[model samples]
Target chain A: MFAPVILSIKVAAIATIFAFILGVFFAHLLTSRNIPGTSIWETILILPMVLPPSIVGYLLLKVFGKRGPIGAFLLDTFGIQVVFTWIACVIAACVVALPLMYQGAKAAFQSVDETYCLAARTLGSSEWKIFWTVKFPLARPGIISGIVLTFARAIGEFGATLMLAGNIEGKTQTIPTAIYYAVATGKEDEADVLVLIMTLFSFFMIFILNTWLKKKNYKVS
Target chain B: MGMYFKIKKKLAQFQTDVEYSFDKGVLVIQGESGAGKTTVLNCISGLKTPDEGEIRIDDMVLFNEKTNIPVKNRRIGYLFQDYALFPNMTVEKNILYGIKNKPEYRDRAKRKELLDYAGYMMETFRISHLKKRYPANISGGEKQRVALARAIVTRPRLLLLDEPFSALDARTKETVYEEFFSFKASLGIPTILITHDPRESELFADDRIVMKDGKIM
Candidate 1:
C-alpha cells in the first residue's frame, strides 16, 4: 500500500519539476514575438494532451524501445536501456503532464502588460533581468497553477505508465497501475482505497491552488 | 545636445511621416486622438522602430537604415502614460531599479554611492515616507512621482513623457506640474512630451509641433 503511494508521489514530483521548467521556457520562447508558424509548433507541443493515453503510451514505447533511435543510442554509447525502468515512468509522466504546464504558463506570460516590459527596458534593464524581475513574478500564479495540474496529471498517469513501466510488485507498480491490477483481479477493497487516496491528493492540490490564488488576489486588490 | 529624427512608419489608419529636432527644455508634440502622437515617443525611445529613416541625438545615432540601438542601450528614459510601475516592487526599489539592480553596480561601495542619489530623488519627489509602500497602495500623484523618480534615477541624456499627467485628476495634475518644472530645471535634460491637451501644451511647451493624421502640421 505504502510502496505504491510513495512511488507515485516520487514520480509525480520529479516529473512536475521537469515539466514546469521546460514548459515555462517553451512558453516564453513561443509567445515573446512573432515566430513563423508558431501556431503549428504549439499544436504539435500540445498533441499529447489531446491524444488518447494508449496512443501516447504506444508512441513512447516506439521511441524508447530497445532498438529505437534514442534507446539504441543510449545502449550503444553508455550500455544503458530506458524501457521498463524507473526512468521510463518519469519520462512518460513528464511527456503527458508537460502540455498542462505549457498552456498555463503561456497564458500567464501573454497576459503580462507590454507597458511594464517597455518601462523596464527604458530603465536600463537587461532582457534577462526583465524576465526574472518582471515577467516571472507577474506570471507566477499561473505557473503555480500549471505545477499543480502537472503534478495531478503525472500522479494519475495510467496507460502510459502501464505500457512503459510494467506492473511489478514494489519496484515499478505505481498507485494507478496497482489499482488497475487490483480491480482486474477482484480486489475491490484495495482498489477502493487507492481510488480514495488518488481523489484526495488531487483535491488537496486544487485546494492549495485556490487558496493561494485567492490570497494573492486579495493582496493585489 | 539637441535631437533630430526623420521617420516614416505606415500605420493602419495613416502613414506617419514626420521630421523634427529639439535642443533642450520641453518640446510638446500635440495631436488629436489617432494622430500617432504616442507612436512618435515610442520611436524616439527605440521601443518601436521606425519603418525607414534615421534618428540621431547630437553626434550619437540611435536608429537609421544601417543601425538600430537596443531599447535598454538607448538610455532614453520614458515615463509611460500609465506610470507602468513594476507591481511586485516597493517605491524605493522601483526608484533604484534602473541602476542598483543591474550587474555594473554589484560593488558595495558603488551601490552605496548611487543610493545617495536615489535617496535624493525620492526625497525631492516627496516620496520618502511612501518608500516602503507598493504602487497600488500609493495615491495617483504619489505614483506619478515614483515613476518620475524611476525614469530619471539613471541620469539618461534624454527623457520622454507620454501624457504623464493623463491618469491624474485635475487636483493631482496641478500639484505635479509644479514639481515637474523644478525637476526639469535642475536636470536640464532634453525632453519630448506628447499630449492631446492644448492647455498642457501651452503650459509646458518651449517649442511645439502640431500633428494631423500623423503628419507634422
Candidate 2:
C-alpha cells in the first residue's frame, strides 16, 4: 500500500534532479551561445512533451531493453539491468517531465535583462563569469520553480512509466501504476486514496511556487 | 592615453559612418535622439561590431576587418542610459563586479587592493551608505552612481557614458555632473559621452562633436 507512495516520491525526486541539471545545461547553452541548428535542438528537447507517453515509452524501450545496445553494454560490462526496474521508472519519468523544466529554464534565461549581461561583458567579465554572477542569479527563482513543476510532472507520470518500468509492486510500482492497477482490479477505495494524495500534494506545491515567484518578481512588465 | 574609432554600419533605419579621436578627457557627442550616438559607443565598446572600421584604444586595435577583440577583452567601461545595474546584487557588489572578474585581481594581495579601491570609489560616489541596498531599492541617481562605480572600478582604459544622466532629475543631474567631472579628472581616463544635456556638453566638452544623421559635423 505504502510501497507505491514511497517509490513514487523516490522516482520523482531522482528524476527531477536529473531533469533539472540537464534542462538548465541545455537551456543555458541554447540561450548564451549561437550554436548552429538551435531550432533543431529546441525541437528535440520539446519532442517528449508533444509525443504520446506510449510512444516515448517505446522509444525508451528500444534504448534500454535487454537486446538494445545500452542494455547489452551495461549487462556485459557492469552486470546491471534497466528495463522493468526502478531505474527505468526514473528514466521514463525524467524523459516525460524534462520538457517542463527545459522550457521553464529557457523562459527564465530569456527573461533576464540583456542589459545586465551587456553591462557584465563591458565590465571585464568573461562569458563564464557573467553567466554565473549575472545570468544565473537573475534566473535562479525561475529555475527553482521549474524544478518544482518538473517534480510534480514526474510524480504523476503514467503511460511511459507503466510501459517501461512495469508494475512490480516493491520495485517500480509508483502511485500512477498503483492507481491503474487498483482501478483495473476494481479496488476503487485504494485508487481513491492515492488520487486524493497526489491531488493535495500537487496543489500545495504549485500554489506555494506561484505565490513565491510573484513575490520575488514583483514587476509585472 | 587616447582612443579612436571609425565606424561604418547600417542600422535598420540609418547608416552610421563616423570617425573621431579623443585624448584623456571627456569628448562629448551631443545630438538629438536617434542620431546614432549610442550606436557609435556600442561599436567602440565591442558590444556591436561595425560593418567596417577599426577601433583602437591606447594604440591597440579592438575591432577591424580582421582583428575583432571580444567585449570582455576590450577593457572598455560603459554606463548605459538605464544604468543597467545588476538588480540581484547590492550596490557594493555591483561596484565590485568588474575587478573581481579581472585576472590580475585573482591573487590575494591584488584582490585586497582592488577591494579597497572599489571601497574608495563607492565613497567617492557617496554611495557607501547604500552598499548593502539592491539597485531596485535605490534612487535613480544612486543607481547611476553605482553603475558608474562598477564601470570605472576595473580601471578601464576607455570609458563610454551613454546618456548616463538622462534618467536623473534636474537637481540630481547637477550633482552627478560634478561627480563625473571629478572622477574623470582624478582618473584621467579617456571618455566618450553621449548627451542631449547642454549643461553636460558645456561642462565636459573637452573635445566636442555634433552629430547630424550619424555624421560628425
Candidate 3:
C-alpha cells in the first residue's frame, strides 16, 4: 500500500516535468502569430483531456501493445517493451495532465504586454531568448499553477493507467491503482485508508498552491 | 549617419502618407488626437507594415513592397505613450532587457556604461532609488523614466518616442524633458519624438512635422 503511494509520487513527478516542458512549448506555439494550423493543433492537444480515461488507456494499449506499430518497432530495434510497464503509466499521466498545463500556460503568456517582447526584440535578443528571459518570467505564476494541477491529475490517475500499464504490485501500481486493487480484493479497510490519504494529500497541495499564489500576488502588487 | 523612409498606407478612415528623415537632431511629430502621429512612428519601427512604402535605417532596408523584415530584426528602439515597461521585471532588468548577452559590442563594459548613464538619468529624473522596483510598484514618472532607460540602453540606430510625457504631470514632464534632452545631447542619436502637445513640440523639436488627416502638412 505504502509502496504504491511512493510509486504514485514518482510517476506524478516524472509526468509533471514532462507535461510542463511540452505544455509551455505548446502554449507558446498556440499563442504565436503566423503559425499555420495552430488552431487545429490546439484542438488536437486538448482532446485527450475531454476524452474518457478508460478510452484513452484502451487507445494507448492498442498502439503500444507487443505487435502494435510503435511497440513492434521498439522491440525489433531496441528490445524494449512499453505495454504494462511503468513508462506506460507515465505516458498516461502526461496525456491526462497536458491540457491543464497548456491552458494555464497559455493564459499566462497571453496576459503579458506585447511591448515587453518588442522591447526585448529591439534590444537584439532572438525570439528564443526573449521567450526564455522575458515571456517565461512573466508567465511564471500560470506555469506554476499548471504544474501543480498536472501533478494532482497525474497522481489521481486510475482508469487510463490501469488499462494501459496494468496495476502490477510494487511496479506499475499507484495510489489510485492500489485503491482499485484493495477494493477489488475486498480489503475494504485498506481501501478506505488509501482513499483518505489521497484526499488529504490533494487538499493540502491545492491549499499550498493557492496560498503561494496569493502571497505572490500581494508581493507584486 | 541616420536614415530616411517614405510611407503610404490606407487605414479604415485615413490614408497615411508621410516622408521624413532623421539626422542628428530631435525630429518631432506634432498633431492633435487621431492625426496619425503614432501610426507614423509605428511604421518606422516596423510595428505596422505600410500598404505601399519603404523604410530604410542606416542603409539597411527594414521594409519594402517587395520584402518585409519583422520587428524583431529591426534595430529600432520604441517608447510607448504608457511607458510599456514589463511589469514582471525589476528596474535593473527592465533597463537591461534590450542589451543583455550580445557579442563584444554588448558586453559588461557597454552594459555598465549604459547602466551608469541610466542611473545618472534616474537621479536626474528623481527615480534613482527605484532601481529594484517593478513597474506596478513605481509611480507614473518613474515608469516613464524606466521606459526611456530601457529604450535608450540598446543604443538603437533610431529612437522613437510616442507621446512620452502625455502620462505625466506638468512638473514631472518638465523634469523628464530636462533629463531627456541631456541624455540626447550625450548620445547624439537621431530621435523621432511623437507628441500632440504643440508646446512640447516647440520646446524640444529641432525639426517639426505636423500631421493632419494622415498626411504630413
* Top candidate, metric DockQ: 1
lDDT against the true structure, per candidate, is 0.88, 0.89, 0.83
Q: For candidate 1, give the DockQ.
A: 0.61
> TM-score for all predictions?
0.96, 0.94, 0.90
Q: After superposition, which runs of candidate 3 have C-alpha atoms over 4 Å from their true positions?
A: A218-221, B1-3, B10-14, B32-34, B57-62, B65-74, B105-126, B169-171, B174-187
**What order do you get sorting by DockQ, best first?**
1, 2, 3
TM-score of chain B of each: 0.96, 0.95, 0.87
- Output the lDDT of residue A190, model 1: 95
Q: List the residue pairs that clash in candidate 2.
A: none
Cα error of candidate 2 at position A221, Å = 12
- Candidate 3 RMSD computed on C-alpha atoms after optimal superposition onto the true structure: 2.8
Tens digits of lDDT, candidate 1, A1-221: 87999999999999999998899999999999788999998998899899988888889888888888888888899988888887788889999999999999999898888888889999888889899998899888888888999999999998888888878888788999999899999999999999999998888889989999877741230
**Comparison by DockQ, 2 against 3, better one:** 2
